[model samples]
Target: MVIAIGFEGSANKLGIGIIKDGEVLSNCRTTYITPPGAGFLPKETALHHRENVLAVLKDAINESKIDVKDIDVVCYTKGPGMGAPLATVAVVARTVAQLWNKPLLGVNHCIGHIEMGRIITGAKNPTILYVSGGNTQVIAFCRKRYRIVGETIDIAVGNCLDRFARILKLSNAPSPGYNIEQLAKKGKKCVTLPYCVKGMDVSFSGILTYMEERAATLLKEGYTEEDLCFSLQEHVFAMLVETSERALAHCNSTEMMIVGGVGCNERLQEMMEIMCQERGATLFATDERYCIDNGLMIAHAGAEMYKSGIRMKWEDCTILQRYRTDAVEATWRKD
Candidate 1:
């Protein structure tokens, strides 16, 4: 019967969600979109969250039809995100917790995604591929920790896609990645792009640099935007699939789950599904509702931690920008 409210403003999105026990009652969010050829800045994104967070919170509570006094805890993402935006959300969460006299819990952003994925997809002990604007990693639950077996050496795959989208001047209305996915569907050819995968880790900076340097030349030489987008996706996703397969083998796991913003890409999901089928494994994934960053994830993860006797004091609720996925102990899960 525990009720919890979670706040998430890790990057461009400001989300507020309410959950009762393990059931999500309301999930509300607003995004801070930048214009084409531009990425969200910390200051601007923080401003957006500050302006919209209250409205989103109000909507979440209203939609849930729950009284504020019934909430048992307040949760927020504390790390592995843009500093200003994370801090902005943390401030709001702390204020709300104090005002409501509820327990406060700080959650890791990556763990939030993983926990949410597990709850929504009902995947147990699966090797996870976590790809987002800020992170890229292949993880498995081992010894009460989300152990990272593979990761990006440089920029995340989503960042690579978003930067390339800027070079192509793609719209950021829904997202740069979504626009690229649409354009790639029309591509009939796969242009060769650098595929850099060193053992278990993948690198995207070299490929991004190569594309940036030769984009105009390639276009003039008869390659369309669709071709370039398709090629980029194929190479990067192949790298991801390769590393994920290795992680699955390393962990001796028969189930695979994809979580994070990039997990919403259909092509990536299809490729992973093929790989899972070949490996005799099950693939678990959620749509944009759980795949993209949202407050529900924070609330769910925080509630799990709280149920496991984890709590954060007022003085200990500090925001971190580089919190690793493996840093948090998954105390809530026995496996």
Candidate 2:
């Protein structure tokens, strides 16, 4: 009968969610969107979170239909995100925990996504492909750790798409990547882009650089934005699929779960589904609700950790901007 509330402000989005046991009661969020051709800055993003977090939290609690006094734990994302945004959410989480006299737990951002995916999709011991604005990795649960099998050597795939969207001046209303995905659907030509996959790892910086240098020239030479977006997705997603297949083989796992913001892309999901069918594996994925960054993930992961006897003191609840997914012991998982 444990009740937990989680706060997440890792990047541009600020989310608050409430969960009881393993079921999500409510999930609320707001995004700090920047103008076209621009990315969000940490300080500004933090300011947005500070301004909106309380409202979002109120919404979550209200929607959950729970009294604050009933909450047993307060959770927040502690790492692998922008410094200002992470600190902002941590401050709020700490304040709430102290005010409510509840236990506080700090969760790794990546593990939050993975745990949420597992809970929502009911996938057990699946090889995971985590792709987001800040990270790109192929992972598997091994020896109480989410071991990385393959990763990006440079920029994340989402970051690359976002940056390219900026070059194309795509709207950041919902997201740059979403806009790119939509444009790609209308593409009639497939321009060749650099595909950088080195063994188990993939790289997107070279492809981004090539696109940045040639975007204007290619447009003038009869290439549409849709064409460029289509080509970029084709190459990058192929790279991801290739590495993910190898990871599945390496881990000998039959299930593949995709988690993170970019996991919302239908084309990527379609591509992965084809690969899974060929490999005789299952693909587990959630929609934007669980795929993108959200507070429910933090609450879910934190609840798992708390149930497993993990706790944090007030003094120990600090942010780690570079926390790795493998650093946290998956004590909640026995197998």
Candidate 3:
């Protein structure tokens, strides 16, 4: 019956959630939506987290219907994210832990997604295709660590999509990626884009660079934005699917799971499903609640760590901007 609260403001999203045992009690979040043709600045996103964290915390606690004293641990995403935003959430987590006299746990942002996805989908020892704004990796559990078998050499797939959305001046209300998916649905042509797959890893910056140049030429040549969006999605997702398939074959695992912000993409899921079906494998994914970056994941992962006697000393709680998934020891999982 371990109870925990998690604070996650790693990038643009500010999320707070409460979890008991392996079940999510409450999950609430808000994104710092930037204007069209602009990206979310770290400083501005941090400010947004600082201003809204308390309210989000309160909302989560209220919705969870739990007393402050019942919370046994306070957890926060400690790394693999924007430094300023990560620091902002860490501050709130530290303050709450001190005020409530609860233990504090620092969680890896990437591992949080993996843990949550496992809990939600009940997939044990699955090959993970983690795609997000800052990360793109094919992960498998080996000797108590999430080993990255394949990854992006340059910018992540999600970042490529977000930046391309900026080129088209798409709205960031729900998400720039979502807007791109919607536009892609309207496209009829499958314009070819650069697809770079080096061994098991996939590169997106080259695709992004070529697409940007083509967007300029195509827009002037009477090609619609929908056409460009469709081309980008098809090419990028194929790379991801191909890399994931390679990883699955190498690991000799039949189960595949997708996690992180971009894991919410239907098109990506569709492509992955088709790939998995052709190979007689299963694809595990979650809705935005578990797929997207949210406090529930941190809380869920941190609570497991806390139960395993992994607690962070107050003074030792520091932000990690480049925390790799393999850096942390997964003491919670035995298999």
lDDT of 1 by residue, 49-89 (tens): 99998899999999999999998889999999999999999
Better of 1 and 2 by lDDT: 2
lDDT string for model 3 (22-91, tens) is 8778999988998998999999999999999888988999999989999988999999899999999999
Arrange candidates by lDDT, descending.
2, 1, 3
Best by lDDT: 2
Model 3 bad stretches (over 4 Å) = none
For 1-335, candidate 2 gives per-residue lDDT tens digits of 77888899999989999999888899999999999999999999999999999999999999999999999899999999999999999999999998998999999999999999999999999999999999999999999999998999999999999999999999998999999999999999998888899999999999999999999999999999999999999999999999999999988889999999999899999999999999999999999998889999999999999998998878889999999999999999976
lDDT of each: 0.94, 0.95, 0.92
Cα TM-score per model: 0.99, 0.99, 0.98
Give lDDT for model 2.
0.95
- Alpha-carbon shift of residue 304 in model 3 (angstroms): 0.9
Cα RMSD (Å) per model?
0.7, 0.6, 0.9
Candidate 3, residue 331: lDDT: 90
Candidate 1 C-alpha error for residue 167, in Å: 0.3
